[model samples]
Target: MLFRVNWRVKVPSLYWTLMSFSTSHGAWKWADRLRIRRTTVDDYEGVVSVRSDINRGCDYIPGTYRQLLKHNTGYAGFIDHELVSFMFAAEIDNGCSVVIQSGRIKEEYEGRGIISAMKKHSFHDLSRTATRSVSVTSSPFACDILLQRNARLLCKMERLIFATSRHALKNTQRSPKVDQSSTIPADDAFLKNIFLSSEITSTIFPENRLVIRGTPYELVTSNIERILCLSDQILVSKDYGTGSANLISFGSTWRSNHTDVVFINLFGESVDDKIIFEHVHRHVAGKTSSCEDKIIMYIVCTKQQHEETVKRVLKKHSWELLVVHDLYAIEESYSWMN
Candidate 1:
């Protein structure tokens, strides 16, 4: 069983005495509350903000992000009344993604070492379960947390694409109804279009149903290491379809959390160029399924095969059609300060 290194030290009496004076000493309040409880949907927004503040690279999905967490083991650390510090870890025993999501300490509360205190609580919660493992992305702070906690770094990818597809419910002048609800299953027909049928995907061209509104395809793969990357994910047609490959390299283990299955690379093989990728994107967008939440798919690929990579991804999740994209290129320029 994995556990935290015992790096305990006596808290200086002066610090505790100083903390006693301030009401915002809410960190301890959170630590106290967590002792007898677990986190829930109610604490999402606060934690989301912390996640956003700490990682400023991407957008967030609050509605469905925490939905699946309820089914598995979840942990939260509330500071200053709201959940200022949070960790969303998934269990190895479960089929869900064991993500050690956003962690943050509020601006005013930074110097207090609140993150470590909150992590202590999180690790304690995780230790109760018999699950063998969990997953977390790479972050300097998170790296420290894992190291201090004594968790193994089983595996990691440099650039993981945490992508999801959302039905752009028009929030304009008129109140139009969303034909589909707010969330969809990861294995629905829509996702299947982008994940289940790649072999026959080349048969279809640009005629498949596709959605092209949000993030542009070129921007998605501009930095991805691929041959000819395009911006797209799911695609569908009369008979065959594709997986989230518009901008993805079919399957590159960037943000792949699937514990049981791994995808094959469709780079430089029996793949078709031309409209194959576009066709799959079209089918993925126009397809309908029972899922209601926003749907999105992530792909990683060889830089040389970016453009036609979608043709390979479509063979899998051809049913669960949704938005598709590749991981953002890791900019070495920005890391110099770190």
Candidate 2:
């Protein structure tokens, strides 16, 4: 097993609580309109007008006249005759978090605590819906409102344009160089290993699962960083061998003697992991490092072929490689981060 360390995912923007505000009553009354509480569907056009820019980017568009109306099972707040703020909350399997997604106030309504009022109302509504968390990506203005409202830090993932000290210590900040001729043909074995590993849920993952097919000789220092920063594993097919896994994970459940080992990352429906793993161990065993980080070259394949990769990886050199089972967990680790 190549597992070693584990790290947590941090959601950058979110609010823990909001200052109390009076609830809305009796329709969109201007005098008390600011206190009005209702689903966004009521003020569809108004909300869209207020958040024109934000709505444009939403899957259902920020203010798309409740095109995301179903998303409003919880709360949508309106100030008077116009919708000023709204939130969407959904509780699915793996994990759940409600996202304020979008909120806006009119030019004239900017400073009156209208957005705050809506946020306060939305929070309460989402809470009632059993929503444990929420996330918002864009809208600098909204980010502030959320912060002021007191969103707790779920996680803060920054784009480290440059390698961090930890990364440097691990020696994983570099781009990989794959010689064209050295590119391993996507064969039945390669394909099988990627898909059947149970690590992948589907072929074309919701998140991009990168699998770089190249020779080790071609992999550059930068390539190491890219792999460390991006992929779940590195696969070096025995027949097309060239690189070594040079770093360990922030956290790993797998163990490897090769300080610099190469693991594979593929998404296919073929099997024969034994060959792949033996290849990886053979190539990596040559490196001299004790950092124990598994920095490797990644290769993505299909659902079926993934099995072959694992088979080769696990059975290789008489079961020498510890096959890390779940790719989803791996993919999600660095893949989702900025």
Candidate 3:
């Protein structure tokens, strides 16, 4: 699904104390002054303002903020009637889990317990139905805080970012001989079987979790359809030598800050380097519009070797490596009577 672009727009340790603040006078004073509530369309400007203050390059919130607000999943925090923090508990895996996304607090409000308070409110609202909470972060401090909360570390992946223009990518020469037949478009039946296959569940996915566009979904029958719906193109690559599925990849496209963005999630430990490039090529080509348009591509790989392979391929294609991030996936499960 393609989303249109609407251009706009954590310190852990002491955080625990702030989150667990009791009914003491001091805590009450702080709690009474801050207001927490579900976000509405009215909060759009405030959300954009808070995001702008952080100065994070190329944010997707401005474009998808409204879409994310659907299902009443967005939440915000306010002090003196100013929106300081915001978060979204996006439902995934057939509503059996929610992956927290776009959580942010103004730079001035960092470590002031604003985010913790917002999380407390949001999770409380989702507690009855959402049995699992999942999040992906590149910040070591955030990872530490999740670990402190007893969230299991599912797996870490290398986030590879590349910046290139449509012209550069289009002009790049293709590999002399790529086994195009090895990769094929994945249909409903193919995805249902591959995603649930025991071999794929144990080996391709990290810890039985399928991380797509930075959100993790457990590899299960219920999640197969959602996964297929979320991705624009799902490709399965086979090893001709062995005639076995060797890699499965998901690609998605959206507009952010006037530039086209393509996100590719690759699952497999043993994949051909050429095939990896081919998958990326197909996604970018499908979205490329003008020669002058800029494109940013984010690729997530579970294996270090795959990361290296992607780097080599991008370099060969004249794509500039922007920055690589060490991303971690954390999850915590809850038990509740149905």
Best by lDDT: 3
Tell me which of candidates 1 and 2 scores higher on TM-score: 1
Q: Report the C-alpha lDDT of model 3 over 45-68, residue by residue, as the tens digit.
A: 888777552212556677667865
Show how many residue pairs clash in every candidate, following the order shown.
68, 102, 0
TM-score against truth, every candidate: 0.39, 0.33, 0.82
Give the alpha carbon lDDT tens digit for every residue of 1-338 in model 1.
Answer: 11212214212211211221233545554445432236677766654565332212222324334644653345555543565544444332222212233344445444454544544444445645422323333233343444444544432222212223233311111222222221122223443344235543333212121112111111121112211122223222221243323322232111112111112222222244333343333323332233233433333333334423453444332323222323211111111111
Pick the TM-score winner: 3
Residue 95, model 1, lDDT: 21
- Model 2, range 68-150, lDDT digits (tens) per residue? 45533434455544555544433221223333433444444444445444544555554444333344232233334445545
* Model 3 superposed RMSD (Cα): 6.3
How are the candidates ranked when ordered by TM-score, highest leading? 3, 1, 2
Ten consecutive residues with minimal summed lDDT in candidate 3? 1-10
- Give the Cα error of residue 321 in candidate 1, in Å: 22
